[model samples]
Each structure stands twice: as structure tokens, then as C-alpha cells.
Target: MNQQRRRQMAENYLVIWVDGNINMANEHCQNTLTQLCGVVNEVNQCTTAEKCIETLQENSEKTSFVISSGALGQHLVPEIHGMPKLDGIYIFCGNKQRHQEWAKNWSKIKGVHTSIKYICEKLAVAIKQCDQDQVTVSIIDINEGDASENLNQLEPSFMHTQIFKEILLDMDHGRQAIKDLVKFCQEKYQGNRKELKFIQEFERTYQSTLVIWWYTRQCFTNKMLNRTL
Candidate 1:
């Protein structure tokens, strides 16, 4: 496995919360979970263990983490244990001692939470660990090819340029740093002066790095094509 494969696996994860009535869970904790890891896609809230099981049946390959309350954990963990796609389980309870004792029986249960904040912190930490594990996989597959072969695969179209720019912005680089990155790309690629000036003028007003990145890729692609021709 390589970094790219690991990243694909990481992206396939589905973070879900399970309980009798998910609405009873504190909204703040839910928001925190979303803020920390919800970017994976959406935070799935399952009101019942049955629904969660059914969801897992269809999406197990994408189910990385399942969060359940202590009341539901006893029944839910048994049903989902040994499933192929379940990386780990996190269970929260008002009773710390009971939750800890119950968590001991399962090797997959990574933590026992006594409070919503505690569980949120634990989930965030575990997700980071999961990402690290994915990153640690040894690279075993490699394909050697000629320069022209690789170049032929590089279909640098407008869409490709836009996608690359979006990825660069999604990295959450700071506003000023993004401005600098756009300017750097323009200079490196000898991009259009007029477009660069437009970006410079609009950069402070737009309040979004994504717009800046988009224009930068556009001008950079033009220069690159001219140079190649």
C-alpha cells in the first residue's frame, strides 16, 4: 500500500453515531465531532442500532468508525464485531466504571467516555490515529515508466487545473499565504501579467482563497501551454 491508496481508504470512511434517539445527545458534541472530522463527508446519525446495522451492511467498506451510547453498545457491538470494514468502536456512558469494564471485553473498542466532550476528544484523537496508521502502510507496488508515458497521462485541461487549485485551497493554507502561493505560481510559470494584477486587486476583497487559487491555475495553465508549444 502507498500513500495514495491509504488516502483513498481514509476518504472512504463513514463516521456514524448510534443511540435510541440521537437527538437526545448533546448538540455541542455533535457539532464538535462535525467540526473535527465531518469533512470526511457527513456525520451519520442513526437513531436505532438496527438502522445502523442495516447501514453498515450496505456501506461497511466505507464504515470506519461507529460511535454508540453505553445503552446501545452492549447490543450493537456484538452484532457488528468481526465485520470487515469496522476499524474500531467508540462507546460513551454516564457511568465511567461500567463503560470501562464493558470496553475491556472488546479489543476493537478504543475508548470509554463519561461525557460528551470526552468522547468528542477521544474520537478526534482516534481518527488522527487511524489516518496515521493509513499513512504508515508500506509502499509495495510501483510502476516504472518513461517520461513521455507519464507526460501523456498528464491531461492538463481547464478542469484539471481547477481541480488542482481546489485541492491547494482545501489544504486550509492561510489567506496571506494563499495569496503568496498564487503569486509564486504566477512568477514560476510566467503567467499573464494582467491576470496577476486582477488577482492582486481582488485578493483582499474576495475573502476566499479558493477564488484566488482558481484564477492562479487559469493563468498558470495558459503560460504552461504557451511554453510547451
Candidate 2:
């Protein structure tokens, strides 16, 4: 581990609570967690599976743990697994058997708890451990290779910076990461028409690294694209 990795580990993490009925989650899960996870003074709450996914999309870098009730867990857990920077994900289930069956497919899921106390206790421990884990960051030069080759080589560098960059472009998660990278690129080049137009098409198409590689290659090679918007 190096200073960069330590900084990443120390980055503030949010504990998200997902439930179809936000009120129930807040009253039971949020209230209990607010008391237990003091490091996370406030918890982000989402009412539906879609909202939960959107929340994760927007804050994946800061999310350490997520607690989803049975209603939302079925949809939320799978999405959580796809997220980057998340240390743990758990489900609050009323039915043990059904969740157990679902849990079989999601090995990364921390646990399924019937009581709020159990979930909070486990989350607190996991949060502490995740916060403590550290790594050193490395920089990669995209200038060394062709667009496609550079895209493949840039994966490690992206992982250090983007967190979820390891997911393959063929997977849904990978495509989402590319979309995120495009957004990052867009932000990096806010006023550049060419780059912005390229990103717009990237978002509209349903494709893989071939396209992302082309875009990244263009960004890397075109000196004009380098100037900040």
C-alpha cells in the first residue's frame, strides 16, 4: 500500500438503505444504523430498485456498504455486486429460505439478517475493515499503444482510479463503467465540441470496448482534445 491507496481507503463512504417503502427502512434500518455506524453519521435512502441503482450509479465511489430490505434486496443485491468501492452488501429478509436461495448466486453478499441489530453490527465491523484496507495507486500512460491495445492496458490504471474498471466491457457492469468514463471524459472536456459529440454517440450506442477504445484513443492522440474545457 502507498499514500495514494491509503487516501482512497480513507475516502468517506456512505451506507445506503434500499427499500420499496422508504419509510419502513428509515424507521427500522436507518434509525438503528444511524446509532451503530457513527462513522457514517447519515445514511442515503432510496425507495425503489430503480432509484437504488441510480443512487449507486451516482455515488459508487463513496459507497462502502448497502442494506436492502427483502422487497428491494432481490433487485438491489445483484446491482450492488456490480458496483465499485463497495465493501459489503446485505439484505434484511423476512423469509429466510427465499433469501438463502437468492444468496447462493451472490457470494459477495455479506449476510442476510432478520434483525436490524445483527445487520448493523456486521455492517459496522465490515465498514471498519473496508476503511482500513489500503493500496498504492499507479499511473499508466495511454500514449504507449494503439487505441484498442491501450484500452486493454489501461484497465489496471482505470481500476485504481475508477474502482469498477475491472469489469469486462462485455458485461452490463463494464458498459456502465464506460458510460461513467465517458461522463468523466465529458467533464474533463466540457467545452470541446468534437469530444462532446463523440461522447454523445458513445452513450446512444449499445456496444463494447471497440467503441470505447476508439474514443479513448482519440482523446489520447488528439492534442487539441487535451485542453480543458
Candidate with top TM-score is 1
83-145 per-residue lDDT for model 1 (tens digits): 888987878677878778767999889888766566656665665555444422122333475
Model 2 TM-score, all chains together: 0.49
Each prediction's whole-model lDDT (CA): 0.59, 0.59
lDDT of 2 by residue, 63-150 (tens): 4677888767877776668676777778877886778777878866888887777887787666545433433345656664576787
Task: Count backbone clashes in candidate 1.
Answer: 0
Question: Candidate 1 at 71: error in angstroms?
Answer: 0.9
TM-score of each: 0.52, 0.49
RMSD of each: 13.1, 17.3
